[model samples]
Target: MSVSSVSVDLYSEKQLQQLVEEISLRFFDKPFRHRAFFNRRLRTTGGRYHLQSHDIDFNPKVLEKHGMEELIGVVKHELCHYHLHLEKRGYQHKDRDFKELLKQTGGSRYVQPLTERKVSYHYYQCQDCGGMIRRQRRVNVSRYVCGSCRGRLVQVTKND
Candidate 1:
């Protein structure tokens, strides 16, 4: 397989944006002004809002492991801080503005934990004959491939 192989997770970028916008309106009664993007480097954090650029960063792993509902909760949590601070209200976790907004909007008080991670599959290939395989998880396909000519690579049996 060439380095060009691209694997896209289930969620699309547009979907994330829609979720952010929806949460902003539903919770703060205000629009989210900055962009939201997945930060691949993010590991422990679910989401972060930059005070300087006013942009929102989210860990894609949060959505990949969890579901949409969990992602929405994270967005709501971030928006609580974003809106309150922009309004010149205390937005820190200790501040009254932050506490009030969180309760009133029913946003999460703390970051939710991501779901237990499952190993991701990006397809597979055989070394001997350039045979390609697809799988949901890594497999020792070496013992399982083209029975004829022993052309190592076997197309993954699963639709995924």
Candidate 2:
């Protein structure tokens, strides 16, 4: 049996702006007067709201990898920051108002991972303490020592 892959068309920047505007008006009952566009440079974050410019920059990987629903959730999350900040209310993630607004709008608190980390970890063992340490890069045994017991470290193995 063969599985056919369906191609999904992503939205352009102009369409993204329009979508943001519509979501803002419908959910928040407020108009998004600033610009919204896809930002290809965004790596881990789903979307970012500019404090000074009030513009929203979205990671295209959200829609590309997740789909339209996840992208909308990201838009809502950014809009929470946008609207609250503009209103002179609490806009930061830790603020009560921001949390309330985010919950009411059904915004996503965290986005799915866009890409997997391909980093390999180097495992080390402390001679004195028998503690294990994991590092992405190799640590020099001559220079670095274990903090717990000041023991010399020996490389155990490398794992992906």
Candidate 3:
């Protein structure tokens, strides 16, 4: 399904659980007996499958940024780990069974890397002392003087 059509903004933990269960049955031909929920704390990972608890944790960012298709791929990838581990098959990323199952189910091999937010800093340099200064917000060069030598601060670069 298209990411835009999934309406993930309103999705809750219950819906996430149901989606995982549905995907498990549809793609793996097995039932997902464990729980699945959105983990807002997940930063870089798309999803994580707990080996001990058998529960799945999904990064909400996946749905927010990548959409439903990417979320489903992540679900499938976790499911591959879930089912394979339970069945005593190779479940690690380096395992043959894991690779084959991931390929067969069309699961994402890796989480799509999140775009890092860049902070633009205004750069200033002292005209007399040559001291460098960086500020998040623009500073009035005429009013603000260099901290080191109290010299006139000149705008060196707008952003970096």
Candidate 4:
């Protein structure tokens, strides 16, 4: 999928629930009556549906990295759990109803890992002379120097 910059209006909690309801209607002939929201603190998992609260929490990283389509699939996956549990059908990953709903709805079997997401970098520079310095690992200015002028390379603040 194509990558896009972070967007704030991606989906509201109400809009997400509506999306889930629409997907359920389109594919499963059911309605999704639950809460859905973006959970920015979610790290590795794409989405989670709570049985007790009947709320779906999504990973914001999915929108940041994989964009809209991937986010939709994640919502569908959570809807699988939401609908099945409410209907008194099997609602867990290993249950028959859950698996069947997931397959029929074309939902992702599991949330993708966040490791593929883009990461910001920390950059350092030399102040004494005009030079470029880059390091994933921070460099100690006391030991590092600009080779041309034999001038010390002061550690400039990082970009990230």
Full-model lDDT for every candidate:
0.70, 0.90, 0.88, 0.75
lDDT of 1 by residue, 1-160 (tens): 1111323445566667766887787667799878887788887788898898888888887767765556666787788778877888898889987888788877666555655566555565555766565556556665666544465664444334
Q: Compared with the true structure, what per-residue lDDT tens digits does model 4 show for residues 23-132?
A: 77777787766667878888888988887899888887887777777887887888888888888999988998898878887888866677756665545556667677
The 10 consecutive residues of candidate 3 with the worst lDDT sum are 1-10
Clashing pairs in 1: 131-153
Total backbone clashes of model 4?
0
lDDT of 2 by residue, 53-107 (tens): 9999999999899988888899999999999999999999999999999999999
Best by TM-score: 2
TM for every model, in the order presented, reads: 0.62, 0.80, 0.70, 0.62
User: Model 4, poorest ten-residue lDDT window?
Assistant: 1-10
Please report the TM-score between candidate 1 and the true structure: 0.62
lDDT of 3 at 36: 98
Candidate 4: lDDT over CA atoms? 0.75
Q: Name the regions of candidate 3 deviating beyond 4 angstroms.
A: 1-5, 115-160
Would you give me the overall lDDT of model 1?
0.70
**lDDT of candidate 4 at residue 48, scale 0 to 100:** 87
Give the Å error, residue 102, model 4. Answer: 0.9
Ranking by lDDT: 2, 3, 4, 1
Q: Which ten contiguous residues of candidate 1 have the minimum total lDDT?
A: 1-10
